[model samples]
Target: MTLPPELSPEHWITHVFSAKAARQGGVIRRNLRDIERYVGRSAFEDELKRRGYHAVENAGQLIIFCNQEPIRLIL
Candidate 1:
């Protein structure tokens, strides 16, 4: 799957969980701000929805979770 050239790391979305950052049960979000600022909230939400992922905005950042099983988070 090829992505648009503008969607490189610098302007990419993230969905990796860090065990070390986990507390109780959830992982810490270190890149939320970067993702929100880089991708822009509206575009990010649209992409997630188009890709079949559920999106929520919390703390002014986008949170995406796969709606289908066998979670696959793509951008």
Candidate 2:
């Protein structure tokens, strides 16, 4: 289901992060610009920390890992 566009950035992100897909250890990708524009960098980072999740930025996208697991670089 798609969320209405009228929701605030924080609300939107919260819903996405709490969705079934996310809860099942799925990864969610979002546009970096949209996040920075609506939530601000610091606020976004704080939310991630509060949720005990991990995120990475790549190619102008923010990739969020829903579970609280140590992230390792394989490259």
TM-score list, all predictions: 0.42, 0.79
Q: Which structure among the candidates has the greatest TM-score? A: 2
Model 1, span 1-75: residue lDDT tens: 344646654335543322333323332343466655556556665665665555455676544454433444566
- TM-score quality measure for candidate 2: 0.79
Worst 10 residues of 2 by lDDT: 1-10
Query: Candidate 1 — what's its lDDT?
Result: 0.49
Q: Pick the candidate with the highest lDDT.
A: 2
Residue runs of model 1 more than 4 Å from their true location after superposition: 1-11, 14-32, 60-62, 69-75
Backbone clashes under 3 angstroms, per model: 0, 0
Error of 1 at 9 (Å): 7.2
Q: Please provide, for model 2 over 1-75, each residue's C-alpha lDDT reduced to its tens digit, 9 standing for 90 to 100.
A: 655657798787777677777979988888888777667778888988998999999999989998899999889
